[model samples]
Target: MKHLFTPYTLKSLELKNRVVMPPMCQYAVSSKDGIVNDWHYNHYVSRAIGGAGLIIIEMTDVEPNGRTTDFDLGLWSDDQIAPLKRIIDACHQYGAKVGIQIAHAGRKAEDADIPVAPSAIPYDENSKMPHALTTEETKEMVEKFRLAAERAIKAGVDTIELHAAHGYLIHQFQSAFTNKRTDEYGRDLALFGKQVIRAVKGVMPAQMPLIVRISAREYVDGGYGIDESIAFSKEYKDAGVDLIHVSSGGEGPILAHGKPGTHAAYQVPLARDIKQALKVPVIAVGRLDEPVLANSVIGNEEADLVAVGRGMLRNPYWALEAATALGKETEIPGVYGAGFSLKK
Candidate 1:
């Protein structure tokens, strides 16, 4: 049976194992320039050294104001390319293929003077109101996404993931609760996301697979559920998305009526449903920190890959430790060989 340590491939991207380090924002950009520094380098390369098969960089915005915070990364300028390439190259040396999540915070762009969204709505009562983008401006936003993908390719990424989840720009456009527009974007909820998938795919190599991360179940009343997500995801798949990264609950505060389970592997079923419904591969995430539990997801063919976010944050060597626990043979650096060796 396939397990977490098994090698996997899709298009041109090949992985040494099924373990993925999903993007977790550090908010660590010094100087507010969106250029990665020492903190970013060490944070990602350590995970590569620790044996992760894939390391997806955090949500990088398309424009300065598109950022969730001033400290978040951006690909709006050509100058930002080299710094990112440095990180990607270092990670590759350690055997981890890299990808980046291109996103725009939209209504959730806390640090923008005034955020932008599909509708003139505040994220919540306390949140600042966002300017509704006109039709032309919305089209321009798609171009920004295309440019970001072009830069990522120049930075030497093996793949690219569009951050359409977590209440960001794409999610705002897709959710009826947030998008109250009468324009074409609202007429078809998946239109903006589909445009983005096609735009990014245009710049990417045909052999490079594109991943789209979507919140499979929004845990608020009036928000979308798995069925709605499956419908929209089908549109994305048809638009050139190769894989779906299943996650949940970033639209708004969770309501009593739609509360999600807190147990481990709670999101596995969601991933399974999407994979079976769409006939596409998926990366399952959410509280899957246990090695055995993560392996079981792969063994059962529930998800093609497993992402351990919080667990990887706490232990840079989480993959190495998992290999030890699962009795799987994984390469450990000779410098760190003593740590993994068993004393007779």
Candidate 2:
């Protein structure tokens, strides 16, 4: 049976194992220039050294104001490319294939003096109201995403993940709760996301797979659930998405009726549904920190890959430790081999 330690591949992206370090923002950019600084470098490269098969860089915005905060990473300028390339090169040397999540925070861009979104909706009562994009401006956003993908490719990424989940820009456009537009975007909820997929795909090498991260189930009232997500995911798949990274619940406050489950593997079922419905590979994430539980998801064919976010934050060598705990042999750095050997 396939397990967590098994090798996996998608198009040009090859992984030594199914262990993925999902994009978790560090908010560590000290200069506010959106460049990858020492903290960002050390944060990702360590996970690579610790044996993460795929280390996805955090939610990197396409424009300066598109970021959730001033400190978030951005690919808006050529200056940012080299720093990111440096990190990717280091991660590659340590045997971890790198991918970066290109995104815009939309109404969720907290630090923007005035944020932009599909509509003028504020995320909540305390959130700032955003300027709805004009049709022309909306089209420009697509170009921004395309440019970001180009920069990521230039920086040596094996794959690129569009951040369509977590109540970010793409998620805002796709979710009715957040997107209240009446133009072409409103007429077709999936249009923005589809355009983005096509735009980003255009810049990527044909052999390089494109991953779209989607919140398969929104946990707020009137927010989309599995059925709605599957439909849009199909549109995305048809538009050139190669993989779906299934996550859930970033729209708004979780209502009592729509509260997301806090249990381990709670989101696996959603990932499975998307995988089955779309007939595509998916990376399952959400509280799947335990080695045995993560292994079970792959062993049962519930998902294609497993992402350990919080667990990885707690231990950079989470993959190596998991290998030891599960009795699976993986290539450990010679210096770290002694630690794993103790398990035998």
Residue 198 of model 2 has an lDDT of 97
Q: What are the TM-scores, per candidate, against the unseen true structure?
A: 0.98, 0.98
**Candidate 1 lDDT tens digits, 103-140:** 99999999999999999988888888999999999999
Candidate 2 per-residue C-alpha lDDT over 1-344 given as tens digits, one digit per residue, 9 for 90 to 100: 79998899898889999999999999999978999999988999999999999999999999999999999999999999999999999999989999999999999999999999998988889999999999999999999999999999999999999999989999999989888888999999999999999999998999999999999988887888999999999999999999999999888887846356668888999999999998999999999999999999999998999999999999999999999999998999867787785355
Top candidate on lDDT is 1
Which residues of candidate 1, in runs, are more than 4 Å off?
A: 257-261, 342-344
lDDT of 1: 0.94
Deviation of model 1 at 341, angstroms: 3.5
Whole-model alpha-carbon lDDT for candidate 2: 0.93
Model 2 lDDT at residue 15: 98
Clashes of 1: 0
Give the Cα-based TM-score of candidate 1 against the true structure.
0.98
Worst 10 residues of 2 by lDDT: 254-263
